[model samples]
Target: MIKVAGMLLLLDFQLLPPTASSEAAKLDSLFFFLVALCGTVATLIIIFILYFVVKYRRRTPDQLALSGRSYRTLELAWTLIPFAIFLFIFYWGAKLYFNLMTPPEDAIEINMVGRQWMWKVQHPEGQREINTLHVPLGRPVKLAIASQDVIHSFFVPAFRIHLDVVPGRYRTIWFKATETGTFHLFCSQYCGTQHSGMKGDVVVMEPEEYARWLNSGSEGSAASEGQKLFRQLSCNTCHTGDSTARAPFLGGLYGKQVNLQGGDTLLADDNYIRQSIVDPEARIVAGYKPIMPTFKGQVDEEQIMLLISFIRSLKEGREQIPPVSDPAGPQPSPVGDAIRQSETNANAGNQPRTNANSTDQE
Candidate 1:
């Protein structure tokens, strides 16, 4: 029992999981507020119901009751009061939702791929985890999650985060840990027969401890692997910076604004790049022809993310972090250099618009 201002409250462990993330405390306050509000309203309603049952009961067999007694002021008060409460809830929930959904600009991005029975996590530093996720304490970590099989929900009660890992697109969620500990990870959606077994642990550790752990078994960097895969898949053949190169140069193209065939312009984000690789024909560059074949069957979700990472490393000013091995870094190309130096106008005649060519496409 806990004693507050003249009141005693019972708190049991069953109320919620351990609050581990920064969002959890705020969410708990909101949850308890809602529960108290509803509980109070219900208690008052029950008291009123009981009082009316006795006071308005039939005392005599021939008793005549009052009819057509309209409480206009009472009606307005009740309706307006509940309306105001709902409005406050909506505003509070919306503000929190907005804050939670928008990941911080500097948050660490981790890629997650969900399958039938397990989760695949890849850190930017190239460490891979099967079902467990390791994050640094007090740092904002954003998860770029996708499903390879069916719909699944990435739920962590301690973190107050629950997001659907849907197929066909990436769903992102961000959380900053407040306490360093292991929390339960679950797929809250009913996916298949072994849905209950789709569980994991989220391990939060000190920043230095996490760095040591990450570097312990580091796979060569994700960008390096992606670069290797890019060559193995013959992507370098067309996406070169040579003067005679057919396709548009890929250097400094990650966050550039691109013009599509229908004059539609959008940032070259992960989804845009993913669509360009998988569909090829969905969104074409304004000045280029669609000749690149679809890589839908050639690459999986993880590979797509790797490719994105590789491309992201090509940002002109930002030197590549978590260095890519083998080639030392992304090589400079005449066309890519020209594209990088020039302005972002489609008709600039110097800016490389599409990663396309006369006969070969990609």
Candidate 2:
């Protein structure tokens, strides 16, 4: 537990899949069961009241005075029955609520900020996502949600959980989708006229698929378009090669430990990657000038993911800046590493050849 100016912020990141965990399934079942019970009870009460009214009505010729007296037994039954039912509901609801509120030891933490008509998601891996949310299926996804504007609700109906996102404070909610598929997201609170139009998909996919999606460009799997954008922006110029470039070499960077210039080491995951791209000042890579232009409003989350994908791929090998169409194609090269090595080898070979020529001339 790390101290933060006297306030304790829990760090829970979920790495395990959802099916392997039983808590989410239990809460889902309990929630529907209680809802069903409420509906059934209401139906029965309405039917019973209707039946008594019809059966106990006095006929037109009856001269007896209609007493307005209430029955003690009837009142007691009504009061006790409701009280007991409420207690039952409260206990069951509280049990589920507690489970949802308190995350498991291994639950993954996702920093989620709700802005006007959009969602800004940050992964521990320096991966950033907009509108779309991709989480490994079956893993408990605990979202630390806050609103940039008014109130919003992070809702995934399939998970049967919704969190109220309030400004000036953080609200968290967790859910593990039992099945993998694209789920609907709705802002439960009415924020603006477009509240109904503000929508996105919560894709609960297999872990492999999630990884592929993260790496993949907007156009294909395994490489994101952001990777292409990174090339277009010429980010590879300084980030790769032995050119005495200012920034960290992006090759083999994804999932690798990065030693920041400020002496801070961070895992080059989603959020870190996003911040480094947009706000390079946050965690300076030590040697590189913060000369990186801030992408702030210029780049969206999808583009950021693509850029991250490209960086992630770069970390693995000297592949092409624009990853080739074929996976078997050659990887992009470091801006200057390969060239520098080739130059050294070429110079060494030439020197020996030159000496041989001089011997012949002598």
Poorest lDDT segment (10 consecutive residues) of candidate 1: 332-341
Report the poorest 10 consecutive residues by lDDT, candidate 2: 353-362
Model 1, span 150-195: residue lDDT tens? 9999998889999999899989999999889998999999899999
Clashing pairs in 1: 291-361, 292-361, 292-362
Candidate 1: residue 338 lDDT (0-100): 21
| CA lDDT of each prediction against the hidden true structure | 0.75, 0.61
TM per prediction = 0.82, 0.52
State, as a TM-score between 0 and 1, how close model 2 is to the true structure.
0.52
In model 2, how large is the Cα lDDT of residue 196? 82
Over 4 Å off, model 1? 1-13, 56-68, 317-362
Counting only residues 3 or more apart in sequence or on different chains, how many pairs clash (N, Cα, C under 3 Å) in candidate 2? Answer: 40
